[model samples]
Target chain A: MAFPDRFDGLPAAPRCEGVYKVTGDTRGNNVAIDVLGVTKVFGAADSGFRALDKVSASIRQNEFFTLLGPSGCGKTTLLRLIAGFEFPTEGRILLDGEDIAALPPFRRPVNTVFQSYALFPHLTVAKNISFGLEMLGWPATKIASTVERMLALVKMEPMADRLTDQISGGQQQRVALARALAPNPRVLLLDEPLSALDFKLRKEMQIELKRLQGETGITFVFVTHDQEEALTMSDRIAVMSAGRILQVGSPREIYDRPTERFVADFIGETNFLEGEAKVAGDRLLEVRLDAGATVKATAPDAALHAGRTTVAVRPEHADLVPGDGPADLTGVLKNIVYFGTDTHFHMTLDNGVPFIVRQQNTPGEGSGFSIGEQVGVRLHADAAQALKD
Target chain B: MQPHEVEQAAIRRGTMRRWLLSAPALVIIFLASFGPLFVMLAFSVLEKGDYGGVKPWTFSFDGWANVFFQHDIFTGELGFADAHLSIFWRSVRLSIITTALTLVLGFPTAYFIATRPRKTREIWVFLVTIPFWTNLLIRTFAMQEVIRNEGVINTVAMRLGMISEPIQIMYTDWAVLFGMTYVYLPLMVLPLYASMEKLDFRLVEAAYDLYANRFKVLRRIILPLTKPGIIAGSILVFIPSLGAYVTPRVLGGGKNMMLGNLIGLQFGKGNNWPLGAAISITLMVVVMVALLVYVRATARAGGDDRGR
Candidate 1:
């Protein structure tokens, strides 16, 4: 679109100047936001809840970074600290190499589209979009032009006169994004803005948000508990559990080679086989399961001569073979689940653990599996990884 | 009966039963309210009798005439006088003042209470309502004691040497205004509290995040959202204060009489029941007109909000 040319009239993105810079990975020149060892404790010192414990991450400029976790895992708390709604009990939050930990919400150059949208019920869509510009003391003409541009950006020009309550939930979400983006904040914090919508609208908005983020070239720090959303839209994802970041990497890295058991379990469905492992050779490890099945997989860590470890593999990677041929494992097929495009074979391993294998629904494939039928499950060594128990 | 006719009859019976359930309360309200009103309307056009009662089958416009015109005893003619008009004007002025004062005091108080933590909100609301349990007359008397010369306020002021002589506060216009404001303060606070409690506090945080200062947040967001409560509280305080009787009669010291006091005088010592009924009906009409105006304004406001 011709939108990028419109922002040329505005000044360049704000940069910190004339201040003594902290020399560390936390405050790099190319980084848009640097959260440095921030610990947030709620309640009193004697007996308090540490909502975020030494959480540190650096978001690159124009990156879609996600803090993904379940509820109460401090993802929203970390977002609030960045938005300046909550103060961290320890450490600093830097914006463009300048510390903004002491700044109020208004003083900081960041805006948040709240999970509830938080639209002013009394104002029209246009008025809500223009609010931040008006607060910044822009001229009426400037604010009007900016508001018009924003409404067009969100494709909400026709509903500009409608109050917030008069619009649907998805429309309100777009208006919130427009309102936050109108001010041209350096970073926009989204606190699960799509969690309120139905499945279809949420999918549409997910793609729209990615497009908007690409068009605006603003750093987005999105917080959500949905792992699929993080994997689909984010340049990098931080997997958090129990107030600590377990892993931070690109989606492919997080999904393919999760460093921790929690990250492997939380990101997607995985079948974890408990076994004893030892380094077989270069780039390979052999794990002997309790049911007398020996499997070879790639070791995630090189310094692993492990006594006890777990082999994690996705259900799609494990295949169901016809008979008791040369196989890595064998189980009894307990159930078959048809899921439109694929079928899942629920099996009980010889060790009495439930194992699932998913196969594509090919046109010529026969109904070769049934309840309580004996089957052999084979795992591709390249697709499986050995993880610390 | 035939089958279809029997079905129709059952439907009729169902409708009748529903109406029968609501008929009793509806009948009682109509009688209790319209009964006295019809009597008052009839009395307003009748002639005054010899013993503080209306004369039957005798009608005149003298009660309405007496409100705006003064009767000359010798010349047997009537002309305009400001006596009754001034009383009505004073009542309007006092009502407006009382409503304004209550709002000025109630808004901040209600906002404070509503902004409090959820655990302590009910306690503050209970404290606001504690005054309602006491008799209003006793409360007015207590106010009189506090504001009277040589009363609590004057005694304390004299001892503190802020003033050597006692202040002439009681039995004045200020005393009546004080009593009205004190009695009706809770009426204003309660409605304001109801709306403020339902206000979405997240909007306030959003406004702050958008760089709005506290005052702008209040002016643009809080005040506009809570306007319904303001209008409701104003009507609650204004209508009653317009026709308040005891406060003006006791604290006004008979020098500055309001419509309520004048209406009472016509029915009591003046022995003119027709004139009293006429004045009461006029005050009722004024209050009704005010309520209609408020409703129209709020409706238009709502329409404007949506139409835009």
Candidate 2:
């Protein structure tokens, strides 16, 4: 694949793909967190296990970047490394071109809203918010103004005097945010900040967080396992697995054009058609299925290898036509799930491979197909990405 | 048929079973703990019999009055300037000294052990408590051997030519304090360790992250947070040391007699049961008051995180 001409003027990508890019230019306010080849190992060398394996990604200033991954994927470790709570085994963390890896958490120009909120039980909300200002030796008047401003930002001014233990979990989250932002860090690290909240509160906080990021104009490196959160709030997302970043791009790029099978499966539901790749054209690849059908998919990132591959087609992208067409694959509609927003049809092909087809709930009618009915599943060639095994 | 009835029946059965199982143990504990104390209280107010046994018909304040008001004949052996106040003052001072020394030595040690990694913490706690497994008298005698004129320290100092002659470490107030501290150090540490173990290291980290220096972290975060443990440890060390008999007897010899020694002499050599009982009751009351005050103070200070 040829490099995009637009990226020619941009700084060269780091040699190792997925390693953080830390440029030393002081002119650009766009780059806030530049992590270079960050790695974290738990325990001593004799018994140590690497938690983050040379994983890195730069977060731009004022952008809400999410590190999305399942548990133990080292996303939280990366966030902590950036927050200066945990030093990387080997890496340089530059905050605004200053090497902050050697600096203590207090000295680093970054603040973290821990997942648990970590609000001091003894302190009032006002005190918790003003702690960072006090640390900087700000005068009482300045500290008070900053604290009041932060409390107002989070809409917690009325409850500023309340003890942290007395408030609801959602309110505590806002207090934590207020506290972190009151410090006016160049970058904000949120470690699964919404995981503790209930579903409704999480959604509300997501919107609130996005707005707060915009209002503060500070980079936010949010860590979460929920792909929906990343899709909803992030300007860019880095999908990690097994302590290494698998893919990094905008949410659309990750969801629509995932680079790896793991990223495809992790980000959203997909029916993986196992097959052998055969080049059809410069940009297209014909994957011969194990079950005797051929699938044409757009090659993602790299040229498809000949031996073995899989075509990732999202369930929603595969449409059920009235009857079999020239390019359509025939299947029996085995089941239908009537979700409020969409209707899902589980279909079985002649070779018995189960394929799921999701259709959005349009105004006039729902899915025309029923259980145990014959249907034809059609997918756009552009919707499927050919991935290596 | 109803849920409430079923729950009520279960609760009744649970209560019945609990009472049935604990009846014997409860009775034994009641008899063992309160019986002696009640007997001592009764003796303090009872009229002394011509014989050794108490006269049940007559009760008087004469025994307490004699001990409190005038120097009884037994004072000669006890060697207190005043019969009651002098011995009481000595015991309070010694107990205070023992408690202070125990806190000084035990708090940091307990903090160290508690802050260790989980597996190492268990091992270190076990090491701290190992000395407690032996008989208290045996441990006191062991200390006696170490502090004696020709003991290990003197021998080492002599061999090193640091001193010309053996130092008089044993049979003094210092020896008594040392023995008391050594024996009660574990008692002091256990409660402290329990309190310190619950201390969230994040609190200290949070303090440090707020630019509070090491000393400020210690004073503002660590010390106040571990106040419950300190109070509990002090009570554990102080109450026991006030009435401790074994350490003083073994280490103090005849030179420095604490209240425990005087009480023992009154009961044993002096054969003054009334005086001994009065003194014992006094010590018990003092300890009880001290413990009560500590509990109330801790409760007021919000140190009772245990919710008891």
Candidate 3:
């Protein structure tokens, strides 16, 4: 079948019949890792787990890329394949236009900061940073200078002589980063390096990691299960589920305009309103909610038809108005939740669906509406996204 | 009573309770160990009686002197002799050889078993312990059947035309060494496997990612991490082989007597009870020295690990 014109670097559709394509500029024209049609299966032929199926993507040079998914979603498998700890059962992994699928991990010019930190307890911090350089048969003087430079980069000069177990968790993390980046590999892979740190430390390390990437200008392929971390640090995010890439886009594009229901729900909270979609005009569409309310929205392409679809709306996008104003839907205010920065108005729609509207608490914005009072909810034209069921 | 006095009395009562609870085990160990040790110490310095006994009333240093010197019984003059010294050195050599061989054989076996998948790992470990189900004497006797002049190995080798005549493998120090290694191999493997199982294999992947090949990874990562197990297993094998009696008697054919056999003869046919006790004391001292060295080395390693 002839598919629609997809945006550049968009993955293949889930089904073979057709695809609803998004239009945007292509990303990462200069590729670092070309994972073409990779399929990996673990264990025997009769009984095995299919960790990845026909997974393919291009990681661009000097980009902070993330493979974001839940646990057991093949994100780590893909990372290991690129790191050469694992090989694809089928297809190829190319590094700089060379097929490195058959290469051993020692021969691959890539390093990984393991999730557990995997620091050698027997070695000091300086020795850990110098291991890769020494493995390359570098001279002792060169190794010493490189280790010194890495210690300075990670701001760990004081703890260089300390054993790995003697340092704190955050220090170990910096040491791991310095070790992985010491050899100046063409690409670096990190497997949830911040998961072991505390909340404040994680936040600090996120900015530090981004700065390190920018300073070194090395391509980074990071794997994480945390959506917030991916959104905060990554240049681009590939949302994956059930061994398939659901969507790949910038953080703003993913958060503001998610095309998949999984992506919409996984990245942030959204309301799935059941509706029937119909094309109203060029680049304009309407979804009739089950409660006989028509919501207008804009479609990325002309794939909207007169059929059943789901309208996704972020909780913060809905506005609260007076009970007598012109609104799309009316509900009884059930409760009011006071957050420090924002307030949520929880209500039950006339059609018996729970609706929540978040509003920022201005200085003088009083709790004007009491509980169990009637209220009107309004939606902007650009807020709703109609997705396939 | 005052509060402080009451607290002190309670502390004293708690200490008495704990000591009472552990008194039985402590007394048993003291009786089983120091009881015979005191008797042996007294026997070493006493005068030798005619009927293979120690004279209770007399004291002499002749027993210690007889270890490295010969005395003309009639003249009562002492001269240096190296016969007993040679026996002690032979025992040391055999122990070292047995420990080395077991270490070489056990490391690979333990590594192979530890690296297997979980289900198969249990089975391999079970197989390693299978030799313990039978008696050691029965097992050593069975080993004799394999290495004897008309044994299964000789017959097989003759049929394969590898040798025209049967090779003399039995009744030699080599046979004794082989028997000791076979008997003590499982002791070495168990500790090695225990330590190897606790190793984090992710460090190996990190090493590989850092450009270390297989040999470098093993040398730099696996071997050094498992050094504690190697030391423990070596001590287990070495101590037993040093004082081994049965294997040397049956396999060495009484041609090359180790310290155990020599000490046994001094008390049995040789009828020198004082000398026998003296030699036993000397062997215990040597073992104590070996243990002290190991303790010192491990303590240093521990101190270094603590960043001292």
Q: Using lDDT as the measure, which candidate wins? A: 1
What lDDT tens digits, residue by residue, belong to model 3 across residues A1-389? 22221112334222212211223533334677898999888996447898888998888777789999999999999999999999899999988788999999998879999999999888899989988988887778878887898899899999999999999999999999999998878789999999999999999999999988877777789999999999998888999998888788889888888877888899987877877788988756788898557987655563366778777888899899877998988889999999979898988888888888888888885869889999998986688887644
**Candidate with the larger lDDT of 1 and 2:** 1
Candidate 2 stretches with Cα past 4 Å from truth are A1-29, A44-47, A122-151, A156-165, A274-300, A303-309, A326-332, A348-354, A364-366, A371-374, B1-34, B46-62, B66-86, B115-121, B199-218, B303-308
lDDT of 2 by residue, A319-344 (tens): 88865554356778888998999988
Q: Count backbone clashes in candidate 3.
A: 0
Model 2 DockQ (Cα-based): 0.19
Of candidate 1 chain B, the 10-residue stretch with the lowest lDDT total is B299-308
Model 2, residue B175: displacement in angstroms?
1.7
Quality of candidate 1's docking, in CAPRI categories? acceptable
Q: How far in Å is the alpha carbon of A135 misplaced in model 2?
A: 4.9
Q: Identify the leading candidate in terms of TM-score.
A: 3
TM-score per candidate: 0.88, 0.82, 0.91
- Report backbone clashes per prediction: 0, 0, 0
Ranking by TM-score: 3, 1, 2
Candidate 1 residue lDDT tens string, A209-281 = 9989877777899999999999999988999988899888889888988767888899888888888878898
* Model 3 chain A: ten consecutive residues of lowest lDDT: A12-21
The digit string of per-residue lDDT tens for model 1 on B64-181 reads 7787788777896877747899998989999999999999999999999999999899999999999989887788888888999978999999999999999998877798899899
- Measured with C-alpha atoms, the lDDT of residue A206 in candidate 2 is 91
- Greater TM-score among 2 and 3 belongs to 3
Tell me the chain A TM-score of model 2: 0.89
